[model samples]
Target: MWNGDGTVEVYGFRVFYSEVDCVRRIFEKYPETATNIRPKNQMVKNAYMNNLLDLIDIICLAPQELTEEELRNAESQLLELVEVGFKLDWLKNKLEELCVKKKKMEARGARMRELDGLIMEQRRVLWELETELKNEENEAVSDSARLGFEDVV
Candidate 1:
């Protein structure tokens, strides 16, 4: 959770500083967030939950509709941390680009299939026309042989 205006709440799992550093001898469950994570005075913030509700809701609600087998077979750990809003927007925009690309590819494939069918039909017609042409030429040769003369122009 973040404070209003996208500031860190100062008292949550995402706090900047904590009072609980220890000698390395003891085991610490949740290590303090690294100093390199932000400047000394700067606060880290999460994206506006409302703005990201579409992705968040998908995360929250997807498991309910899945059968146990589906869950087991599902892809692993696709969910990720959104470090900043810009990255999230880039991801969303990238998804839109992929959707558009997929549609264009599908249309191209459909057109190719239609063209292939047309080509097959045209090839059949071409074969039939060639056969008929040979038959007509043969009949003309036989008639000439029977007449046994050439007409001069």
Candidate 2:
């Protein structure tokens, strides 16, 4: 077992060369079991779990080691961060869409204003032409009356 100060201690038993070779083979095949007291398959599974916990702890601490509970808490925090990032991306897209729509609306409004001004100018010209036509008609009628054209009604 490893002490907190980076030293390993084995209990009152001598390690055999054959056992060491077997342990080495097991560790090579399944590196996760290397940290267990007895390198059995079950211990290897537990060691894998412990290593996963340690990785979580390392990620949580950034520069230090963390406890198991801290690692679990960090998982939730990471999830929250991911959710926030997605929400931000969604909001950004919405804002961009709104901006494009607003620009289109402004452009259409400008075009409408231009068309209204053109229509007003055209109406003014038509009115002037109609007044001239009325004056010409009245002049012709007066001329015809002076000329005494009885059939020119």
Candidate 3:
């Protein structure tokens, strides 16, 4: 356990091997034997619950800042929570709210992208018109100079 050699079946958050190794090192350094601790599975479930709550709070705080993928992930996790007997009315309401928000976000994103494309096309057209006007002006000046020179000759 101290060497972090065995494959750990992580229950709550996704963790890398390096983090597991660090945790192992910490435990090796500071070994505290607590009396009457909860069972391993119960501890894992509590940790999972805490992590999920934290994620929900974060999503509630800044739902707009999250990307579509992130929102989907949260929704799926919420569903998982429901499957695990966490059937709260607020959770269902939050799930519905998140669905609506995701749809709105997608629609807004599509519209914004469309507007950006239109703006780019308009700028391109404007550049071409300005170039054409400058070319015409230069040609007119050259033609006038030529006519003046011929009259003088």
Write down the lDDT of every candidate, Cα atoms only.
Answer: 0.42, 0.47, 0.59
| Candidate 3 segments exceeding 4 Å error | 1-52, 64-73, 76-87, 144-146, 149-152
Q: Assess every candidate by TM-score.
A: 0.42, 0.39, 0.49
* Candidate of highest TM-score: 3
Per-residue lDDT tens digits of candidate 2, residues 1-153?
A: 444644233221123333344334434654533233333354443343334334333443432233445545545544443343212233233334444555566688799999999999999999999999999999998877754366655
Q: Write the per-residue lDDT of candidate 1 for residues 1-153, one digit (tens) a residue.
A: 444553344322232222112212111422332212332333223222222333433334333344444332221211232433113433344444444555566688799999999999999999999999999999998877744246432
How many angstroms is residue 125 displaced in model 3 relative to the true structure, after the best TM-score fit?
Answer: 1.4
- lDDT-sorted candidate list, best first: 3, 2, 1
Pairs with steric clashes in candidate 1: none
Error of 1 at 20 (Å): 25
Give the C-alpha lDDT of model 1: 0.42
Provide the lDDT at 119 for model 2: 100
